[model samples]
Target: MYCSANGFPALVVLKMNGLEYLEDWTVEEGAMANLKHLKIRRCGNLKMIPEGFRHVTTLQELVLRLQPSEFFERVQENGLDWFKIKHARSIVTKR
Candidate 1:
């Protein structure tokens, strides 16, 4: 998805839901630049976090709730998907 420069300047927190059919997502460079917290819920089919998150320097926290256990495993330290969000100060996963 593309986040325009004028989008949500005050949006520090974001929540996404009902993304069962979403297998992948790609973010444009500088997208969600000011987003500090992100909560993703019920995204069972989302295979991995977007690679573009590495550019979101302002992101401090990530929360994954009600996702598949396997999905949670991939985001753990040393896991395959960990690099995408390792910069975050906090990462929480719930299955």
Candidate 2:
């Protein structure tokens, strides 16, 4: 489960689902610089969103659905992973 490697950062929207093997999702450094929206759905085995999100400074909205409870809990406001995504303008979660 890997995306093609490239140097230019132009992606603006990303959606992923059903990636059981994807334990960690990382957008390459300096890549996805324009990414403004992201959605992750039904990825049961992806324990947590990748730590690299802090580098996606332009990310404005994030939506996560059908993820593990523990994973979701960790990303809750004031949770351990909250800081990584705190800069996102909007964060939504659905069970």
TM-score of each: 0.84, 0.85
Supply every candidate's count of residue pairs whose N, Cα or C atoms clash at under 3 angstroms.
Answer: 0, 0
What is candidate 1's lDDT per residue for 19-88, written digit by digit as tens? 7887777776667778899999998898878877777778999999999888888899998888889999
**lDDT per residue, candidate 2, 41-79, as tens digits?**
988888776666777788999999999898899899988
- Relative to the true structure, candidate 2 reaches a TM of 0.85
Candidate 1's C-alpha runs over 4 A off are 1-10
- Candidate 1 Cα lDDT to native: 0.83
How far is 1's C-alpha from truth in model 2 (Å)? 5.3
Clashes of 1: 0
Candidate 2 lowest-lDDT run of ten: 1-10
